[model samples]
Target: METQARLIVDVARLDEDGERYQGELSLALLDLGASEVFAPKGALAYDLFAQALGTELLVRGTLSLPLNCICVRCGGEFQKVVQDRDFVTSIEISEATDFLDLTDEVREAIILDLPSYPVCSDTCKGLCMTCGKNLNKEICACQKAGSDRRWATLEGL
Candidate 1:
Protein backbone atom coordinates (compact mmCIF):
# COMPACT_ATOMS: atom_id res chain seq x y z
CA MET A 1 0.00 0.00 0.00
CA GLU A 2 1.05 3.60 -0.49
CA THR A 3 2.69 5.27 2.51
CA GLN A 4 -0.23 7.61 3.13
CA ALA A 5 -2.80 4.91 2.53
CA ARG A 6 -1.10 2.64 5.02
CA LEU A 7 -1.58 5.16 7.84
CA ILE A 8 -5.22 5.93 7.06
CA VAL A 9 -8.25 4.35 8.67
CA ASP A 10 -11.58 3.98 6.88
CA VAL A 11 -14.07 5.29 9.38
CA ALA A 12 -16.99 3.98 7.36
CA ARG A 13 -15.89 0.43 8.10
CA LEU A 14 -16.10 0.94 11.86
CA ASP A 15 -19.20 0.72 13.99
CA GLU A 16 -20.51 3.88 15.70
CA ASP A 17 -20.62 2.21 19.11
CA GLY A 18 -16.83 1.62 19.06
CA GLU A 19 -14.76 -1.15 17.47
CA ARG A 20 -11.10 -2.05 17.94
CA TYR A 21 -8.70 -2.43 15.05
CA GLN A 22 -5.24 -3.88 15.47
CA GLY A 23 -2.36 -4.00 13.01
CA GLU A 24 1.37 -3.60 12.45
CA LEU A 25 2.66 -0.53 10.65
CA SER A 26 6.01 -0.09 8.98
CA LEU A 27 8.32 2.83 9.78
CA ALA A 28 7.94 4.01 6.24
CA LEU A 29 4.34 4.86 7.02
CA LEU A 30 5.43 7.19 9.82
CA ASP A 31 8.43 8.63 8.03
CA LEU A 32 9.09 12.24 8.99
CA GLY A 33 11.02 12.86 5.76
CA ALA A 34 14.09 14.04 7.65
CA SER A 35 14.98 13.81 11.32
CA GLU A 36 18.03 13.84 13.57
CA VAL A 37 16.71 11.23 16.01
CA PHE A 38 15.76 8.55 13.50
CA ALA A 39 18.43 6.28 12.09
CA PRO A 40 18.55 5.39 8.42
CA LYS A 41 19.41 1.70 8.83
CA GLY A 42 17.09 -0.34 11.08
CA ALA A 43 13.43 -0.72 10.43
CA LEU A 44 11.00 0.83 12.91
CA ALA A 45 8.03 -1.26 14.02
CA TYR A 46 4.70 0.09 15.23
CA ASP A 47 2.03 -1.97 16.96
CA LEU A 48 -1.23 -0.13 16.45
CA PHE A 49 -4.44 -0.28 18.43
CA ALA A 50 -7.19 2.04 17.30
CA GLN A 51 -10.82 2.36 18.35
CA ALA A 52 -13.62 4.04 16.51
CA LEU A 53 -16.00 6.17 18.61
CA GLY A 54 -18.67 7.77 16.52
CA THR A 55 -16.87 10.50 14.57
CA GLU A 56 -13.69 10.23 16.57
CA LEU A 57 -10.82 7.77 16.39
CA LEU A 58 -8.79 6.96 19.47
CA VAL A 59 -5.31 5.59 18.76
CA ARG A 60 -3.03 3.93 21.30
CA GLY A 61 0.03 1.84 20.65
CA THR A 62 3.77 1.25 20.96
CA LEU A 63 6.58 1.99 18.53
CA SER A 64 10.20 0.86 18.56
CA LEU A 65 13.07 2.47 16.69
CA PRO A 66 16.78 1.73 16.52
CA LEU A 67 18.40 5.15 16.80
CA ASN A 68 21.90 6.27 15.85
CA CYS A 69 22.80 9.00 18.34
CA ILE A 70 25.84 11.04 19.22
CA CYS A 71 27.21 11.27 22.73
CA VAL A 72 26.47 14.76 24.04
CA ARG A 73 29.73 15.04 25.97
CA CYS A 74 32.30 13.00 24.04
CA GLY A 75 30.79 13.50 20.57
CA GLY A 76 31.08 9.77 19.87
CA GLU A 77 28.57 7.81 17.80
CA PHE A 78 26.41 5.10 19.31
CA GLN A 79 23.24 3.13 18.71
CA LYS A 80 20.29 2.62 20.99
CA VAL A 81 16.85 1.13 20.60
CA VAL A 82 14.14 3.45 21.89
CA GLN A 83 10.54 2.54 22.52
CA ASP A 84 7.39 4.59 23.15
CA ARG A 85 4.70 2.51 24.77
CA ASP A 86 2.43 5.26 26.01
CA PHE A 87 1.52 6.61 22.62
CA VAL A 88 -2.02 7.89 22.47
CA THR A 89 -3.84 10.42 20.31
CA SER A 90 -7.25 11.22 18.91
CA ILE A 91 -8.55 12.41 15.56
CA GLU A 92 -11.90 13.66 14.39
CA ILE A 93 -13.47 12.61 11.12
CA SER A 94 -16.33 14.29 9.33
CA GLU A 95 -19.12 12.61 7.39
CA ALA A 96 -17.63 14.01 4.20
CA THR A 97 -14.25 12.39 4.86
CA ASP A 98 -14.32 8.75 5.88
CA PHE A 99 -10.58 8.44 6.39
CA LEU A 100 -8.22 9.65 9.11
CA ASP A 101 -4.47 9.67 8.61
CA LEU A 102 -2.19 9.12 11.63
CA THR A 103 1.14 9.80 10.01
CA ASP A 104 1.70 13.19 11.63
CA GLU A 105 0.58 12.09 15.06
CA VAL A 106 2.86 9.05 15.09
CA ARG A 107 5.79 11.08 13.83
CA GLU A 108 5.31 13.68 16.54
CA ALA A 109 5.09 11.06 19.26
CA ILE A 110 8.40 9.53 18.27
CA ILE A 111 10.17 12.86 18.05
CA LEU A 112 8.84 14.07 21.38
CA ASP A 113 10.19 10.99 23.15
CA LEU A 114 13.76 11.44 21.98
CA PRO A 115 16.26 12.35 24.70
CA SER A 116 17.38 15.95 24.74
CA TYR A 117 20.94 14.96 25.58
CA PRO A 118 22.05 11.50 24.52
CA VAL A 119 25.12 9.82 26.00
CA CYS A 120 26.96 6.66 25.06
CA SER A 121 27.13 5.44 28.64
CA ASP A 122 26.55 6.66 32.20
CA THR A 123 30.30 6.74 32.96
CA CYS A 124 31.48 8.41 29.75
CA LYS A 125 34.39 10.60 30.81
CA GLY A 126 33.97 12.94 27.85
CA LEU A 127 37.01 14.75 26.42
CA CYS A 128 40.15 16.19 27.92
CA MET A 129 39.59 19.92 28.27
CA THR A 130 43.12 20.93 27.24
CA CYS A 131 44.04 18.63 24.32
CA GLY A 132 40.45 17.84 23.22
CA LYS A 133 41.04 14.06 23.29
CA ASN A 134 38.35 11.55 24.14
CA LEU A 135 38.97 10.81 27.80
CA ASN A 136 36.95 7.64 27.78
CA LYS A 137 39.50 5.87 25.59
CA GLU A 138 42.81 7.00 27.12
CA ILE A 139 44.46 9.16 29.77
CA CYS A 140 45.90 12.48 28.64
CA ALA A 141 49.03 14.31 29.90
CA CYS A 142 46.96 17.46 30.48
CA GLN A 143 44.95 15.59 33.13
CA LYS A 144 48.07 15.27 35.35
CA ALA A 145 48.57 19.04 35.30
CA GLY A 146 45.45 19.08 37.48
CA SER A 147 45.16 22.85 37.24
CA ASP A 148 43.47 25.14 34.77
CA ARG A 149 45.04 28.48 33.79
CA ARG A 150 41.58 30.05 33.81
CA TRP A 151 41.37 29.35 37.55
CA ALA A 152 44.96 30.42 38.38
CA THR A 153 43.91 33.90 39.58
CA LEU A 154 41.40 32.38 42.05
CA GLU A 155 44.25 30.82 44.09
CA GLY A 156 45.27 34.28 45.37
CA LEU A 157 41.81 34.90 46.78
Candidate 2:
Protein backbone atom coordinates (compact mmCIF):
# COMPACT_ATOMS: atom_id res chain seq x y z
CA MET A 1 0.00 0.00 0.00
CA GLU A 2 1.02 3.59 -0.59
CA THR A 3 2.07 5.85 2.30
CA GLN A 4 1.89 9.55 3.11
CA ALA A 5 4.85 11.86 2.60
CA ARG A 6 3.75 14.82 4.68
CA LEU A 7 4.32 15.27 8.40
CA ILE A 8 2.26 18.27 9.33
CA VAL A 9 1.88 19.37 12.95
CA ASP A 10 -0.26 22.06 14.51
CA VAL A 11 1.88 24.33 16.65
CA ALA A 12 -1.12 25.35 18.75
CA ARG A 13 -1.43 21.85 20.17
CA LEU A 14 2.21 21.78 21.20
CA ASP A 15 3.17 22.64 24.77
CA GLU A 16 6.50 23.54 26.39
CA ASP A 17 7.61 19.90 26.09
CA GLY A 18 6.65 19.72 22.42
CA GLU A 19 4.94 16.82 20.60
CA ARG A 20 6.08 13.39 19.46
CA TYR A 21 5.36 11.78 16.09
CA GLN A 22 5.79 8.24 14.83
CA GLY A 23 4.79 6.95 11.43
CA GLU A 24 5.89 5.39 8.15
CA LEU A 25 6.45 7.31 4.95
CA SER A 26 6.50 6.20 1.34
CA LEU A 27 9.93 5.22 0.04
CA ALA A 28 9.23 7.08 -3.16
CA LEU A 29 9.23 10.29 -1.16
CA LEU A 30 13.04 10.11 -1.15
CA ASP A 31 13.09 10.89 -4.88
CA LEU A 32 15.88 8.43 -5.63
CA GLY A 33 15.89 7.72 -9.34
CA ALA A 34 15.33 4.29 -10.82
CA SER A 35 18.59 2.31 -10.72
CA GLU A 36 19.61 -1.28 -10.20
CA VAL A 37 22.56 -0.27 -8.03
CA PHE A 38 20.37 0.68 -5.07
CA ALA A 39 16.70 0.90 -4.11
CA PRO A 40 14.46 0.88 -1.07
CA LYS A 41 12.74 -2.42 -0.32
CA GLY A 42 10.26 -1.04 2.18
CA ALA A 43 8.76 2.11 3.68
CA LEU A 44 10.78 4.45 5.84
CA ALA A 45 9.85 4.50 9.52
CA TYR A 46 10.38 7.53 11.74
CA ASP A 47 10.09 8.33 15.44
CA LEU A 48 10.43 12.03 15.97
CA PHE A 49 9.87 14.87 18.46
CA ALA A 50 9.14 18.45 17.50
CA GLN A 51 9.29 21.53 19.66
CA ALA A 52 8.92 25.27 19.23
CA LEU A 53 11.75 27.21 20.84
CA GLY A 54 11.40 30.93 20.54
CA THR A 55 11.79 31.80 16.85
CA GLU A 56 13.11 28.40 15.76
CA LEU A 57 11.37 25.04 15.55
CA LEU A 58 13.47 21.94 16.19
CA VAL A 59 12.74 18.45 14.93
CA ARG A 60 14.74 15.43 16.00
CA GLY A 61 14.14 11.78 15.36
CA THR A 62 15.31 8.36 14.21
CA LEU A 63 14.78 6.93 10.74
CA SER A 64 15.02 3.37 9.43
CA LEU A 65 14.68 1.85 5.98
CA PRO A 66 15.56 -1.43 4.30
CA LEU A 67 17.55 -1.17 1.10
CA ASN A 68 18.46 -3.60 -1.67
CA CYS A 69 21.88 -2.78 -3.04
CA ILE A 70 24.39 -4.19 -5.50
CA CYS A 71 27.93 -4.42 -4.24
CA VAL A 72 30.21 -2.15 -6.22
CA ARG A 73 33.22 -4.44 -5.98
CA CYS A 74 31.78 -7.84 -6.88
CA GLY A 75 28.39 -6.90 -8.27
CA GLY A 76 26.73 -9.11 -5.66
CA GLU A 77 23.31 -8.27 -4.27
CA PHE A 78 22.67 -7.62 -0.59
CA GLN A 79 20.04 -6.19 1.73
CA LYS A 80 20.89 -3.64 4.39
CA VAL A 81 18.98 -1.43 6.79
CA VAL A 82 19.92 2.24 6.65
CA GLN A 83 19.34 4.00 9.93
CA ASP A 84 19.90 7.47 11.33
CA ARG A 85 19.58 7.69 15.11
CA ASP A 86 19.93 11.45 15.33
CA PHE A 87 18.01 12.93 12.46
CA VAL A 88 17.65 16.63 13.25
CA THR A 89 16.22 19.61 11.40
CA SER A 90 15.38 23.17 12.35
CA ILE A 91 13.09 25.70 10.70
CA GLU A 92 12.53 29.33 11.48
CA ILE A 93 9.05 29.94 12.84
CA SER A 94 7.06 33.03 13.75
CA GLU A 95 3.69 33.81 15.32
CA ALA A 96 2.15 33.37 11.89
CA THR A 97 3.56 29.84 11.65
CA ASP A 98 0.57 27.83 12.76
CA PHE A 99 1.64 24.60 11.08
CA LEU A 100 4.93 22.94 10.18
CA ASP A 101 5.64 20.44 7.42
CA LEU A 102 8.81 18.34 7.26
CA THR A 103 8.36 16.18 4.21
CA ASP A 104 11.67 17.01 2.54
CA GLU A 105 13.78 16.79 5.66
CA VAL A 106 12.71 13.23 6.31
CA ARG A 107 13.67 12.25 2.80
CA GLU A 108 17.09 13.84 3.04
CA ALA A 109 18.00 12.05 6.26
CA ILE A 110 17.66 8.59 4.70
CA ILE A 111 19.49 9.47 1.50
CA LEU A 112 22.42 11.06 3.26
CA ASP A 113 22.88 8.06 5.52
CA LEU A 114 23.27 5.61 2.63
CA PRO A 115 26.78 4.59 1.55
CA SER A 116 27.93 6.09 -1.72
CA TYR A 117 29.47 2.77 -2.83
CA PRO A 118 27.95 -0.25 -1.15
CA VAL A 119 29.95 -3.48 -0.73
CA CYS A 120 28.83 -6.94 0.30
CA SER A 121 31.95 -7.48 2.39
CA ASP A 122 35.15 -5.62 3.12
CA THR A 123 37.36 -8.56 2.01
CA CYS A 124 35.68 -9.22 -1.30
CA LYS A 125 38.16 -10.13 -4.07
CA GLY A 126 36.13 -8.50 -6.83
CA LEU A 127 36.24 -9.37 -10.56
CA CYS A 128 39.42 -10.21 -12.45
CA MET A 129 40.56 -7.32 -14.62
CA THR A 130 41.56 -9.26 -17.74
CA CYS A 131 39.83 -12.69 -17.54
CA GLY A 132 36.46 -11.27 -16.40
CA LYS A 133 36.10 -13.75 -13.56
CA ASN A 134 34.87 -13.49 -9.97
CA LEU A 135 38.03 -13.93 -7.92
CA ASN A 136 36.24 -14.71 -4.72
CA LYS A 137 34.61 -17.84 -6.18
CA GLU A 138 37.72 -19.50 -7.69
CA ILE A 139 41.27 -18.82 -8.89
CA CYS A 140 41.68 -17.55 -12.44
CA ALA A 141 43.63 -19.55 -15.03
CA CYS A 142 45.19 -16.48 -16.69
CA GLN A 143 48.69 -15.55 -15.58
CA LYS A 144 49.17 -12.41 -13.50
CA ALA A 145 50.39 -9.72 -15.87
CA GLY A 146 52.70 -6.97 -14.71
CA SER A 147 51.20 -3.53 -14.28
CA ASP A 148 53.32 -1.95 -17.07
CA ARG A 149 55.60 -3.46 -19.71
CA ARG A 150 57.76 -0.32 -19.88
CA TRP A 151 58.92 -0.96 -16.24
CA ALA A 152 60.35 -4.45 -17.12
CA THR A 153 64.01 -3.12 -17.13
CA LEU A 154 63.57 -1.62 -13.66
CA GLU A 155 62.67 -5.03 -12.17
CA GLY A 156 66.28 -6.35 -12.88
CA LEU A 157 67.88 -3.35 -11.16
Candidate 3:
Protein backbone atom coordinates (compact mmCIF):
# COMPACT_ATOMS: atom_id res chain seq x y z
CA MET A 1 0.00 0.00 0.00
CA GLU A 2 1.09 3.58 -0.71
CA THR A 3 1.80 5.50 2.47
CA GLN A 4 1.38 9.23 2.70
CA ALA A 5 4.24 11.18 4.23
CA ARG A 6 1.99 13.58 6.09
CA LEU A 7 0.41 12.50 9.38
CA ILE A 8 -2.67 14.55 10.05
CA VAL A 9 -4.12 14.04 13.50
CA ASP A 10 -7.71 15.09 14.15
CA VAL A 11 -8.09 17.07 17.35
CA ALA A 12 -11.88 16.59 17.55
CA ARG A 13 -11.55 12.79 17.78
CA LEU A 14 -9.16 12.94 20.69
CA ASP A 15 -10.68 12.45 24.14
CA GLU A 16 -9.81 14.30 27.36
CA ASP A 17 -7.23 11.65 28.20
CA GLY A 18 -5.92 11.65 24.60
CA GLU A 19 -5.71 8.94 21.91
CA ARG A 20 -2.80 6.98 20.40
CA TYR A 21 -2.33 5.98 16.77
CA GLN A 22 0.28 3.67 15.26
CA GLY A 23 1.18 2.74 11.69
CA GLU A 24 3.99 2.05 9.22
CA LEU A 25 4.93 4.64 6.60
CA SER A 26 7.18 4.78 3.56
CA LEU A 27 8.92 8.14 3.21
CA ALA A 28 10.13 9.27 -0.22
CA LEU A 29 13.46 10.75 0.83
CA LEU A 30 14.80 10.63 -2.70
CA ASP A 31 11.83 12.47 -4.17
CA LEU A 32 12.08 15.18 -1.52
CA GLY A 33 15.85 15.73 -2.15
CA ALA A 34 16.26 16.42 1.52
CA SER A 35 20.05 16.51 2.13
CA GLU A 36 23.57 15.86 0.80
CA VAL A 37 24.87 13.84 3.77
CA PHE A 38 23.19 10.72 2.51
CA ALA A 39 21.21 10.04 -0.66
CA PRO A 40 18.19 7.79 -0.21
CA LYS A 41 18.29 4.63 -2.34
CA GLY A 42 14.49 4.29 -2.18
CA ALA A 43 11.58 4.75 0.22
CA LEU A 44 12.56 4.78 3.87
CA ALA A 45 10.58 2.47 6.19
CA TYR A 46 9.28 4.08 9.35
CA ASP A 47 7.12 2.93 12.26
CA LEU A 48 5.07 5.85 13.49
CA PHE A 49 3.26 6.51 16.78
CA ALA A 50 1.27 9.57 17.72
CA GLN A 51 -0.73 10.66 20.76
CA ALA A 52 -3.13 13.58 20.89
CA LEU A 53 -2.63 15.52 24.11
CA GLY A 54 -5.18 18.30 24.21
CA THR A 55 -3.70 21.21 22.19
CA GLU A 56 -0.44 19.33 21.66
CA LEU A 57 0.41 16.15 19.77
CA LEU A 58 3.32 13.91 20.76
CA VAL A 59 4.89 12.07 17.84
CA ARG A 60 7.39 9.21 18.07
CA GLY A 61 8.76 6.73 15.58
CA THR A 62 11.57 4.44 14.37
CA LEU A 63 12.97 4.45 10.86
CA SER A 64 15.56 2.63 8.73
CA LEU A 65 17.00 4.39 5.69
CA PRO A 66 19.02 2.84 2.92
CA LEU A 67 21.48 5.56 1.98
CA ASN A 68 24.25 6.10 -0.57
CA CYS A 69 27.15 8.12 0.84
CA ILE A 70 30.48 9.40 -0.47
CA CYS A 71 33.59 8.80 1.58
CA VAL A 72 35.03 12.03 2.91
CA ARG A 73 38.65 10.97 2.58
CA CYS A 74 38.72 9.08 -0.75
CA GLY A 75 35.54 10.39 -2.38
CA GLY A 76 34.31 6.86 -3.05
CA GLU A 77 30.65 5.90 -3.14
CA PHE A 78 29.35 3.50 -0.52
CA GLN A 79 26.07 2.24 0.93
CA LYS A 80 24.97 2.73 4.49
CA VAL A 81 21.85 1.91 6.47
CA VAL A 82 20.85 4.54 9.01
CA GLN A 83 18.47 3.43 11.74
CA ASP A 84 16.95 5.76 14.31
CA ARG A 85 14.75 4.41 17.11
CA ASP A 86 14.37 7.29 19.57
CA PHE A 87 12.89 9.79 17.13
CA VAL A 88 10.40 12.06 18.88
CA THR A 89 8.80 15.44 18.25
CA SER A 90 5.72 17.48 19.16
CA ILE A 91 3.25 19.74 17.33
CA GLU A 92 0.87 22.37 18.63
CA ILE A 93 -2.73 22.66 17.46
CA SER A 94 -5.00 25.69 17.81
CA GLU A 95 -8.79 26.10 17.65
CA ALA A 96 -8.61 27.07 13.98
CA THR A 97 -6.23 24.23 13.05
CA ASP A 98 -8.02 20.85 12.90
CA PHE A 99 -5.06 18.75 11.80
CA LEU A 100 -1.30 18.94 12.31
CA ASP A 101 1.17 17.97 9.55
CA LEU A 102 4.24 16.04 10.79
CA THR A 103 5.97 15.60 7.43
CA ASP A 104 8.44 18.49 7.79
CA GLU A 105 9.32 17.48 11.33
CA VAL A 106 10.10 13.92 10.26
CA ARG A 107 12.24 15.10 7.35
CA GLU A 108 14.22 17.45 9.59
CA ALA A 109 14.87 14.72 12.13
CA ILE A 110 16.30 12.44 9.43
CA ILE A 111 18.51 15.20 8.05
CA LEU A 112 19.85 16.16 11.48
CA ASP A 113 20.81 12.58 12.23
CA LEU A 114 23.03 12.26 9.14
CA PRO A 115 26.79 11.89 9.71
CA SER A 116 28.95 14.92 8.97
CA TYR A 117 31.89 12.86 7.72
CA PRO A 118 30.95 9.60 6.06
CA VAL A 119 33.66 6.94 5.67
CA CYS A 120 33.61 3.91 3.43
CA SER A 121 35.17 1.79 6.18
CA ASP A 122 37.13 2.08 9.40
CA THR A 123 40.35 0.91 7.68
CA CYS A 124 40.01 3.22 4.68
CA LYS A 125 43.50 4.37 3.64
CA GLY A 126 42.15 7.46 1.88
CA LEU A 127 43.86 9.12 -1.09
CA CYS A 128 47.57 9.66 -1.78
CA MET A 129 48.48 13.25 -1.04
CA THR A 130 51.01 13.60 -3.87
CA CYS A 131 49.42 11.60 -6.74
CA GLY A 132 45.77 11.91 -5.57
CA LYS A 133 45.36 8.16 -6.09
CA ASN A 134 43.04 6.08 -3.89
CA LEU A 135 45.38 4.48 -1.32
CA ASN A 136 42.81 1.92 -0.28
CA LYS A 137 42.92 0.15 -3.67
CA GLU A 138 46.53 0.64 -4.76
CA ILE A 139 49.84 2.15 -3.58
CA CYS A 140 51.12 5.24 -5.47
CA ALA A 141 54.69 5.53 -6.87
CA CYS A 142 55.02 9.16 -5.69
CA GLN A 143 57.83 9.71 -3.21
CA LYS A 144 56.84 10.72 0.32
CA ALA A 145 57.78 14.39 0.86
CA GLY A 146 59.62 15.61 3.95
CA SER A 147 57.96 17.49 6.79
CA ASP A 148 56.93 21.11 6.23
CA ARG A 149 59.55 23.86 6.94
CA ARG A 150 57.11 25.59 9.34
CA TRP A 151 57.00 22.44 11.47
CA ALA A 152 60.75 21.68 11.10
CA THR A 153 61.69 24.29 13.78
CA LEU A 154 59.41 22.52 16.31
CA GLU A 155 60.77 19.08 15.40
CA GLY A 156 64.19 19.92 16.97
CA LEU A 157 62.53 20.49 20.36
Best by lDDT: 2
TM-score for each prediction? 0.70, 0.79, 0.66
Report the lDDT of model 1 for residue 121.
96
Q: After superposition, how far is residue 3 of candidate 1 from its true place, in Å?
A: 6.6
- lDDT of candidate 2 over 1-157, digit per residue (tens): 6645577777766777898989887766666553667888988888999999998889898999888999888898999888999999989988888888787788877778877788888998888887878888876765244434436767867
Off by over 4 Å in 3: 1-5, 10-31, 34-38, 94-98, 142-157
* Best-to-worst ranking by lDDT: 2, 1, 3
Model 3 weakest 10-residue run by lDDT: 23-32
Q: What is the lDDT of candidate 2?
A: 0.81
| Residue-by-residue lDDT tens digits, candidate 1, 8-123 | 66777766555454444555766645355335345556777777766667878787677788888898989887789888888876677677877677677777777768889999
Superior candidate under TM-score, 2 versus 3: 2
Q: How far out, in Å, is residue 101 in model 3?
A: 1.9
**Of the pair 1 and 2, which is ahead by lDDT?**
2
lDDT of 3 by residue, 1-157 (tens): 5646555566656555655554434554225464565677766566766666666677777866778889998999999987788888877866676677665666677776677789999999999888899988877666233335446768877
Instruction: Give the lDDT of residue 140 in candidate 1.
Output: 86
Q: Give the Cα RMSD of candidate 2.
A: 3.9
Tell me the TM-score of model 1: 0.70
**Which should have the higher lDDT, number 1 or number 3?**
1
